[model samples]
Target: MQLTAIGINHDTAPVALRERVAFQFEQIKPALALFKEAWSGKRSLSAPEAAILSTCNRTELYCATEAQSSREQAVSWLSQYHGIRTEELAPHVYALPQSEAVRHAFRVASGLDSMVLGETQIVGQMKDAVRTASEAGALGTYLNQLFQRTFAVAKEVRSTTEIGAQSVSMAAAAVRLAQRIFDKIANQRVLFIGAGEMIELCATHFAAQHPRELVVANRTAERGMRLAERFNGRAIPLSELPSRMHEFDIIVSCTASTLPIIGLGAVERAVKARRHRPIFMVDLAVPRDIEPEAGQLEDVFLYTVDDLGAIVREGNASRQAAVAQAEAIIETRVQNFMQWLDARSIVPVIRHMHTQADMLRRAEVERAQKMLARGDDPAAVLEALSQSLTNKLIHPPTYALTSAPANERYLLKEIVGRWYSPR
Candidate 1:
């Protein structure tokens, strides 16, 4: 069980680079299969067990490998697959092995590692990633145990600590950002692009203000309408955004689109129509829904996921206590998980001991049976059998102890006691 977590996160890489490293939802399973196939039966590498967790804030690949050097090879595979140069990707990547990997995993799942500290959405994303890995035949014994324990640790951290208390959610941060530009949210026309979970969260937060007009633009009109109807708003086809872009004072977009949905040209025309009225935009999608260049417009206050990180960090002094408590809990659990991994490492040794003992027992029993068949005293044969089994069990250890150097005798004696002592 040589476990390693390799990849970049919000702490190590900027959003621009993180997006390049990210795995889209539809690409993960096949990419994982390809990852294993790339190194399958290679001289220096074995088939690896892998799972990827990719979100707006981070992209991480957790893997189990055999060779220590193979970890580096895994990193190379990731870089090559994403078309990133090794030197380009190397500085931002982190490769944590065994105990470090265990600690990293526990921290990540518990929300201690999120850009928005103690955010719960990552838990769901991680579960979805693991489920995909399982369906793709990439998860095996080691990764399976790691994630199961990871989930349990996350649940415990959330329940036992106030780590999530006073948390600034991304949606709340968006509203806060909006308030900075507009005096009253109720006075603004808000448009949300895409009808996903993130969009739902932002819409819910903004709806509390009873905005003047709320509209959801989505590719699927029915689903968009269903979501819009909940907030007493309306839905529009995504294609209409180009012509209607000027109608809204604020736009927040998060979709699975591989390219920018809100282009610079659309925003420029919208700005001209508004006579440069300030428009606050949040591009929450990974590849980015809004063009990065659009942020240069005078009326546009464009905030990417990275920008919200600063807004979310404003009141962290209060969470220091809860963060400390969660760290303590995670440390203890990390040690326990490492202990389990250590025990697994010696399983073959334990199996060997059991096999040898079984062979000796069978040989002694066969001798006793032969004696009984020859009309020898049954009690005598049984007594001899018992003595022989005991002697055979202790013989190897006794010989080793006698032959061992004087300096090694103490350690050998201790091992003997451990081996023969009752559980």
Candidate 2:
């Protein structure tokens, strides 16, 4: 089976479409179970081994299968699962087969493919996806090894290069975007929806400005409270979003909810209450917590994850040296991984050759032992054993060279000659 990576990302699709196929971190395992059931018995794909890497920027399925059409099948499955039309999704999806898949995996893990070049967050996200895949029993030898080497390459890239150090993270970009509108963050009230890692990071960055107020609203009240406490802020229930959203000047939201949490009406009302005051908003979630239409409102300066890409890429030119070094490391690792895969593909033939050779050696040894027991000369018996072993080992190739078809004889002879040639 070949390795294949199939999916759409920020580069290929809009946030509206990417979100349609995006899976929440917690939703992966169960989704994999559904995947297994869907592909349980098939002609092109059987017992499909796949690991999904779903993040704010991308949703890719890394699969081990011989199916030449696995990419199309994956697209079909994604559309069906998400209730999206195939024609709409087909154009944006990219399929990387074999070496390309390996290269893509390595690049993604190393953060070379991220909007924020060389950011470290993708490493953790990939590890989590891999762990979840393993837990879901979606992993097999091929995928397991692919990710192992992928992680090793990622580590090498991060350790050997300064790309990661130079990255302006999403949280940092969000802060910078907010600063574009608000002259002083310290005077603005900030509202953060969702207490996930992204939210925590954004809150921390904004807190440094000593914002007048920092509030966290999450599905779980306690979780929100805990995250809020870390920044000396307060927590509110998700239900309070509509009523209290107008109170804050800057709102950053990222949640796992499948639907929009902050709708157009909510933002419209919040804008009305603020009396035409500008409100900076950032939606980091893949599916997004805030509605896209909400961004059209008069007082709302809303940005989605994609909208922050330009800000995060501010100093990429300065990090070109690190980027080049990281790319070199990734290229070497990709070649090594492909070589491992090539070696892996012939493992069954190697196993059979060893098994057959062992059986022949054991049989010859048994015959020689019987001769020795019959009071034969020890020197003669030893000579016979060595001779028998050599002959038996050479027999298969000798027979093949002689018995090969007329057109194939020359090639077979070359193979046999190479096999028996001097070192």
Candidate 3:
């Protein structure tokens, strides 16, 4: 079996394409189950170990399966699941094998692969994906080990390197953009959609600026209220958004909704209510909380996750030294993981060798016992048992060495030498 990481991310595909492939938080468990089933069917093997990490920036399937399953099979499964054509996905997909997959996982968890360099939220996101896959029984020895080691590598990188220091997070970037639209965030009323981690994060940043009013709107009022109270803000049900939209000067949204929530008409109505006052909006959700057309309105400043790329990249220049340090750490960890994977590859062969040796020992012992029971000398029986065991154990290699073709003898000799060599 081999380890593989297959998917498209912000680096490989545009936000529109990434959104098409993005798996919602609730969809992860079912998607993993479906992937395993489809993978086993395609490869004609047992279901492979699998885990998915889906976030605003990427959707990746990390799997361990036999060589019979090609990387193309994985891509086919993803495209099929998301209802896209293989050809369409082929251009954007990056299929990494073994060590590259391990390296990708390490880089991602360590925040080296984030849109906002060295942002630590991806570690938690990865953990959540692993947990979901495990709960779905999609994880096996390989994936479990991969995630465990990945988390360890991320921790080590964060501790030993300055990768996260002064890093500009997505939340911070959103606030930075809001600042560009509004001279003083403190004077603007801010509304956040969804009470998830991203909302919580953005709320914290915005609250630091002491927005005139901070409100959280969510499907579940209780969760929204809980999140809002953390920043001494108020909560409103999502149903109130359209009616109350005009009240907020800035809107930052991140939700798991599979479709756009804030549409063009709704924003137009809100704009009219506000007497055409400019409202800055950030759609951090993969599918996007606000409709793309809403950005066309004269009084609306709309920015999606992709729009923040330039601002996020600004932090990269200062983080070069830390990035180099993190890369060094990731490289060392990748080598260690590859060594472990290599050892795992030989385990079955080692097991078969032990099984064969045990079988030979058992057969010789049985013969020796019968010989002794039939009144044969104990020493003769013991000698015969030793000869039988030694001959049987070396039979395959010895026969190969003697019967090997002239052209193969040198290679056979090397094999025999290694087999009998002292450690």
Candidate 4:
């Protein structure tokens, strides 16, 4: 079987495009089933295993199939489902096969490929995606084994390296950036526009400063209220954002909406209402909840995912020793995994050889029984049996040595001799 990964990530595409393709956890099962059905029809391939990983930074499909056609079919299905132009999406996507795919998965699970280097959240996200795919009937033996190993590798990387220790999270970086703009975080009014994990993290950081006021606006008021209550803040319906936007000095938004929730015009009005007071805004959503044009306003400061990357890089020097150790571990683990894969590829050949040997052994045993029944000498029967077993064991290799090409014969001799020679 061939293993492949096709997807776009923060490095390849902007949040605008990434958000358009992101799938929520609840939507994954049905999506995977549909993807598998479409792939099987187009490629004429049997049931292919598939799993999708979608985060704010990436949307990827990892698959195991019998042929290359299955990989192409999966790519086409993803492009069609997201309504993204194939030409535009193709360049950003990386399609890895076999060993390369295995390496990519290991690196990703270890957080080497994350936007925030060494972020631990991605491992849980990967696990969730795997669970969802299994429930959707998309995971088969190959993908199941691949993902299980991925988790183990992630655990090893974290335990051996300080990759996670010195890294500043995006949420914490957002607060740090806001502090640079304002004299003190306690003097700013912070507003969070979603009730998701990212928003919760941002709220926690900002609340530590005891901001003047904290508010949460969400599509679901009940969810918003629960999150806001934890910080001793207030919650507002998304619909109320237009009128209430002027009250906050700092805005951090990360919502699952396909379209921008806060636009240029709304920000313009908010600035006018506040008499042109400076506002710090961070758009953490993949397809940003805040409008891109808002970054152009004179009194508005807007930072996207790319902008926060530098701030998160602080203190890397302290972690270099740990990173070196982690990389060495990953390299050794990768070699071992590849060895397993190589052995797996030859299983059918090994089985066939064992079957042939078993057939020859049974025939010789039957002959010996007949000789004993006929009252032949026991010593003669034993000698014949030993000679027959030796010949049968050597027949295939001996025949090949005579008939094979010179290079192949030389290679086979070396292999067979080494395998059978005394230690």
Ranking by TM-score: 3, 1, 2, 4
Better of 3 and 4 by lDDT: 3
Better of 3 and 4 by TM-score: 3
User: Residue 317, candidate 3: how far off, in angstroms?
Assistant: 1.3
Query: Clashes in each model (backbone N, CA, C under 3 Å)?
Result: 0, 0, 0, 0
Tens-digit lDDT string for candidate 4 (1-423): 788988889888877778778887677888988888877777677978999999888999999887773445566677898787877677777888887888889889988888788889899999999998988889997899899999999999998677898688899899889988998989889999999999999999999999999999999999999999999999999999999999999999999887899989999999999999999999998767888999999999999987887787664557778767777777788788878877887998999999999999999999999999999999999999999999989988889888999879889889889979999
Question: What are the TM-scores, per candidate, against the unseen true structure?
Answer: 0.94, 0.90, 0.95, 0.88
Q: In model 2, where is the ten-residue run with the lowest total lDDT? A: 36-45
lDDT of 3 by residue, 1-423 (tens): 789898899899999899999988788888888888887876678989999998999999999997644778888888888899999998999989888899999999999888889898999999999999999999999989999999999999999888999988888899999999889999999999999888898999999999999999999999999999999999999999889999999999998899999999999999999999999999999987789999999989999888998799898888899889889988998999889988998999999999989888888888898999999999999898998788787888889889999999999999889888999
| Collision pairs in model 2 | none
- lDDT (Cα atoms) of all candidates against the true structure: 0.91, 0.89, 0.90, 0.87
The candidate with the higher TM-score, 1 or 2, is 1
Q: Which consecutive 10 residues in model 3 have the weakest lDDT in total? A: 66-75
TM-score of 3: 0.95
Relative to the true structure, candidate 4 reaches a TM of: 0.88
lDDT of 3 at 25: 78
Judge candidate 2 against the unseen true structure and give its global Cα lDDT, from 0 to 1. 0.89
Q: Deviation in angstroms for 145 in model 3? A: 1.3
Runs with alpha carbons beyond 4 Å of true place in candidate 3:
404-423
Candidate 1 lDDT score at position 234: 98
Clashing pairs in 1: none
